[model samples]
Each structure stands twice: as C-alpha cells, then as structure tokens.
Target: MPESVSAVLGPRYRAVAVPVDGGDLHVGVWEPEDAAATGAATPTAVLTHGITASHVSWAALARALPGVRLVAPDLRGRGRSRDLPAPYGMPRHADDVAAALDHLGVRDAVAVGHSMGAFVALVLADRHPHLVRSLHLVDGGMPLLPPPGVAPQDVAAAVLGPAADRLRMTFPSRTAYREFWSDHPALGPYRDEVVTAYVDYDLVGEEPELSPATRPAALEEDIRDLVDGASVQASLQGVPARPVTWYVAPRGLMDEVPPLYPDAARERWTRELPTLRLVAVDDVNHYTVVLGAHGVRQLLPHLEADLR
Candidate 1:
C-alpha cells in the first residue's frame, strides 16, 4: 500500500459513536483527503458491511477509493455499533442506516452493500427510494430462499453459521479470538494489508474480548429477523426500479454442502428481477470475491462510472 493510502486508512482507524434516533451506535467514516481540510462535501459512499464483520471489512475498498468519502456503519449489532435492544431484522438495519444518513445530512448518494448488507440495502431502497441516488451490491445478490422441504435448522446453520458460532462462543481470550478469525472462511482470501487493518480497527479495550463490535445475540436476532418470518427474496420487492445490481462470486456457499445457491435459483432471481444488472466474476469464492484486488477492481465501475 502507498503512503497516501496508509495515512488515510490510519495507523489505526478510529471508531466514532453517532447518535441516532433509536440509540447511539459505532461507525467508521473515511473522508477523502481533498475534502478533509477544505470541509468541501464530496460525494459520500456509504457501505453496509456483511453480517459478521464490522467497518474494517470495507477498509481495503475505502483505502482503494480515497477520492470518494466512505461511511461504513456497524449494522445495529455488528461491528462497533450497538447490539439489539428488542430484536433485529432487515427493516431495523435499514432504519439504522437511514438515521446515519440523516445525521450526516446526506440527501442522495450511492448506497453499497455486501452479502447480508446487500439485503439491507435492498430494503432501504425499497422503503426509502427517494433517499438513494443509486445502489450497488458487491458479492451480494437478491437472497432467494432455499427451496421447500429444507429444514429450518439446516438453513440456519448454513446461512447463519458464523452468527450461530458467535452467539454460542466465549473466547478464552482476545488472542484466541484472533486465532479463530485468522482462518475464517470469508476473510481468508483478503490481502494481508486488508486483513491486518481489518483486525486492528476492531480492538475495543483491555477486557481482551473480541467481537464484531456488536454483540453475538444481536447478530442472531438480525439473521432471524431477516430470514425467519418472511422470504428473504421478498425484500427485493421493496427496492423496485432502484437500479439493482450484483457482483456475484461464481462459486457460492453451496460448495460446502447441501448447495445453498444453485445456478437455477440464480437464474430465477435474474429472471424475476428483470432490471437487476449482474456482473459475474470468475474463480472466486464467497469470501475472496469481496476482499482482494479483484474485488476492489470490480467495485469501482459500479460506484464511480455506472452511477453517472
């Protein structure tokens, strides 16, 4: 990484607590260098990270695109943000993001989401179309639910595996926690630069306990809320005509077992959401597709070019 990228990303990126209508939560906002001193408002790009990770998940991209101001809020109970008060779902995640945008006085700008965040982004566009200028999804697609006869336990384990682990865990120490994450299925593919920064940004205090900057139960609540009562695909209906797009990793989570995402299912979504623009990237898994140089490369055109 260049000195400029390093400086902007920070020797250690700071955590900010933003006051929202619902409550105070943590977020990591990276302002473009050109706009920092001048206080000139630049086009802000807010990224809602995936289910288990925090803003650090976007640090690599944020560093890559220093020209665009980036805001990555810890979704309600994930990252550095607050945990669930009652229960969480996609709607709550959207509400949290809407509050952040309002606090920032952002009228309209790009809203990007990844994995589960993509689902939340879709919900936002569906419920509050006027608030978004454009929407971009990186390695996140319209979540088509598993076909019938699928056991809820099996579905929950696969889709919400990491969330389940978090809820059931008590790390002996932060060192143990870090060790556990070093081999995470999703994050293993990122560059060392990204991995280091991603880890460093989320260290809270001397309790020596590590988490996504949110509580474990919060993540479970979020997953249940998003997938339990309604078909995950139904949320897409809310974002109609919002320029939906997907940067799909050709290999989905199904490779592990029971095949969560089938090609036929993907085709079905593409067919149903006729307007969705999907750009499939080859030779990448669910994790690597979102973290490497190629991942960052795939993201630029969507955020900077297509929106124009």
Candidate 2:
C-alpha cells in the first residue's frame, strides 16, 4: 500500500467480499478505533462511489471520520467488483448496497454518494428506506439535462467526455496511466499520493495493456438509466419527502464551466423538491467535490451533523 493509503486507512481498514445475487461485492470497511472498546453502537455510513470509480474514492472521507464506521462498496462493474455479473442499473446497484449493509449488520446509515453513485443512493433510500437514515448526495442525484440534439445513448459520452473515452483506450504501463490522469484538467491539478493510489487501483490488466477497471457495458447501462430511466425520475420525485442534502460543485467533470447541474437546473429541482437543501461548494469540480481536500472540508460539517 502507498504511504497515503496507509495513513488514510490506518489500522482498522479491511476488505471483505459481501455476497450478492451473482457474485460477491468488494467492500472496504474502516472501523473506528473505539469500535472494540464499545459502549453505544458506532455510527455507520454507507458510501457509494461514482459511475467509473470504486471504494478507494472514499479514502479521504474515511480518514477524517475516525469515530464513524465507513462502509464503501465498489458498485458492480467497477473496481474489484468489475467481474461481478450485472443486469446493471440503479436498482441493481441500490440492492447490492442493501445486501452489503445486511451482511455487515448495519442499519440506519448516513448514505453518501458521488456522481452516478448519487443516483444509486437515491434509489437505495427509496427502495430501502429502513437502511438509510439520511442522504448526502455529493455533486449528483438530480436528473441531468442532456445537451440539445444528443441522443439519450450519447449523453454519457457528451457529459463524461475523456472519462468515458478513456475506457476504450489501453495503457502500456501504470506510469502511462498515471500520466494520463496527471494531464486531466480536473484531477491533474489536485494529484497527490491519495489520488495517485486511486489512479493505480483503477488499472487491472497486464502492464503492457492495462485498461481502466470500469466495464464499458456497465457504464453504458448505468449511464442510460441515469440519463432517462423511469426509476431515477421516480426517485427524484420522492426526494422532497426524504431527508436529503445535495452538495453542488460549480465546475464540471473536466473543470469546465456550466456544471453538470447548472443554476437553472438547480432552480428547477429546487422548485420541484422544495425541501431539498443545496449547498454551492465553489472552487471544486465534479471530481474534486469529494476527492480533494477543499471539498472534504466543506463536506465534513454537514456529514458530522447528520451523523449526530
């Protein structure tokens, strides 16, 4: 493990395989130091990563929350769970999370998610309300307005751009992969040991032809659902009645202006889901909204308040 991973994980981190329908889901658990000492039960949080990300994305948040048990899963078709068969979609991902929580004996967790994971979290809260006490949707969950003239299937490519494009390319070595991300406008500027470890974990094949661990099929299926699936629409409609907070990032995936949820869209959603609390986190893009220090700083207070 890299020094940063070691520092973030500390001594209580462990990887477990939670059995789902087809195969096991890879979950990373970070238990608080006092878990064994025990009086009151430890507060638990279930974290879901982005569409193309894995459990490793929660390293920084896990490190910050030493008193709360953080359960983060690599949603199907991403990270170590990439091999797990998928009839992949938001419902499937949500159920997988519920299964992980059941296997771990966790109930009433603060559900946190980023990017596409936010959609999964929303569905989880809707379908498995007993398991989620409150929702912290980081930079996602609202239905995105696809660019005009773009087909429904093309929305992912249009929004994700290089992130979606890189899945088809191959890298000769891990260094090449790191360099590729190092040049990313959003991730590159914030590269550190944690970010580097995240990049390293994303490569799974032989050195000569390593590719991103996200399966293109999974991405395609999930993105399609995210774009226009009925389930997501229903979840969005149900948001007002649920305990939910959406953290918005001003910048986008590629550090571009007009974020995934721009002001106009935010206003519309606000009008629809009157109770939805929106916090505008400036100076961070979609990726950094969770992965970077500034984003983490802004998120900690809200998360801690919810846990309390």
Candidate 3:
C-alpha cells in the first residue's frame, strides 16, 4: 500500500495513486481552505522535492501558499512510492510527474522544485511542455557537472555528504533519527516544527529498528545518472525559455561556505542560459533554502505570479 498524505499533512490534503509505466505514483494534494469558493479551477502549483525527500517535504511551502493548490509526489523509490520498480532516472521521474498532474485534472501548473527535484521538473517541462506554466528552481535544475575524472560515488559524497550516508544507517527509534538530524549542520540550525515534521515523516517501520523511506539503490542510480546521464544533460540543455527563476543558497548541505554552485559557475550559467533568473539567498544552506522561512518568502513571489 502507498503512504497516505493525510497521515502526514493532516485533513486538508488528499492522496491519489497516479498510474504510470512502472507502477502507481503517489501524489499528495493540498487544497486551500477556500477551495469550495474557488470551485474546481483553483490555481495549482506542482511541488517536487529533493532526491531523498518525499511529498511531505512541501508541507511548509503549502502552508505558505494558502490559496493555491499544491500537488507533490513521492517520486519513484521514495516515501509511499518506494516500492516502485527500477529504471529510475530523471526521465522516468518526469513521466511520473506528468502522470500525477493528469491524475489530479491539472492541465498546467507552476513547477516548483528543490535539488534533484529541480532536475526532474526541468525534464517534465522539457518533455511535456504543455503541462508547465512557469518554472521555479530552488538550488537545482541547472547543470551540475562533476569535475573531470571524478567518480559518481565521489560526486554523490561531495554533493550530499551525511544525507547519503543516513540512508544506510538505522535508527532504534524516531527520536534517534530526530537527534541525528538535529546534529546535522544543514538541518540543525533551522530546527522548527515544520522541519521536525519533515524529519519524522522520513522514518518507516517500528521502534528498536527504523529505516529511512528513501531506497539506497534508487538513490545511487539517481546520483550516478544525475552526474553523467545523457537524458539529464539534454534536459538542462533544452530547458524552455518560459519564465524561469532559480534560487541558490550561500551554504552547502554541511553549512559549508562557497556552496554547491560557486560564483564562477553561477556566472557561467547566467552567461550560458540567459533565460534563467538566479537569486542568491544568504544565511540559509541548501536544506534551509527549501524548508526555512526566509527561503519560502523568496520563493512565494515567483510561485504566486506564475499561479496567477
């Protein structure tokens, strides 16, 4: 059985199984309180999370955007969709994202994506142009080419750090998991109710032994492909010239200085992709750039304008 959206997001949301080639993709829908007044045509936004994250990662953003509808999917191999069969990559995820939109009767929506989710969002907009109104990329979606001769594993380690290692580590209890995250440099500083909720939702099974909902093998495949995949390069190379915005955090996953995309690289991206609007967000790291209060405020305007 797939995970329940209401289980994590509470009553205002609904979960649906969107059929795709591999299997049922789980999508969570967060409707505004005035949904009835707006009727069926209420503006919608599609929220896509990072590689190891699930639909619940967008709960904070959903609350920030009260009037607009939020459609977030657990992507293949994560959260409720963890059992989804292999062949996981950006294109497959893109297809699943498109299918989820169709299932929700959403013809088009503003695509909001964070980290790896940003790559999937770009692919979706590229492959299924009709379904995207505008694109808002949060610290991802742009090309992330690894340095020459670097292995995929090294690339994953450099990019994800403790986040990737946590997949293999087991926790005796949810509290243990929370404690582990509380110590993480990226997640530790911005500890709040929403962040705690996001961390708690990542746990599965019972006490004495609990594992993260993210599938390690799937995550590895995604990282390998993301670093050197042909499809990913194609997507980045061919992003639509539609209204697109990108937000980059000053810090990395470990709250390290210089961040994942350095100044030279960012300048190069702007030179190469003139259509992309890149904004520098200070103080917050990669994780905070999506889950933090300041990050949401910067993203709200782009999301709201596109929804309108």
Q: Quick one: RMSD of model 2?
A: 1.6
In candidate 3, how many Å is residue 149 off? Answer: 9.3
Candidate 1 regions off by >4 Å? Answer: 1-8, 11-15, 36-41, 147-149, 152-154, 189-191, 200-212, 225-234, 252-260
lDDT of 1 by residue, 1-308 (tens): 22433454664344567786567867777767677554545777778887766666777687677666677788877645654364577877787888777777777768888877887777777666667777787666465465576665456555766546664555555556557667766555443766655554444444544443556666666665444435345666654566766777766543242233457656877887888787776666665555666767776776777434
Best-to-worst ranking by lDDT: 2, 3, 1
**TM-score (all chains, Cα) for each model:** 0.83, 0.96, 0.93
Q: What TM-score does structure 1 among the candidates reach?
A: 0.83
Error of 2 at 49 (Å): 0.5
Instruction: List where candidate 3 sits over 4 angstroms from the true fold.
Output: 1-10, 147-153
lDDT of 3 at 303: 75
Model 2 lDDT, residue 291, Cα: 86
In order, candidate lDDTs are 0.65, 0.88, 0.83
lDDT by residue for model 2 over 129-231, one digit each (tens)?
8998989999988878766687777777789767778898999988898899999998998998678878888878887989999998898888877678888
**Clash totals for all candidate models:** 4, 0, 0
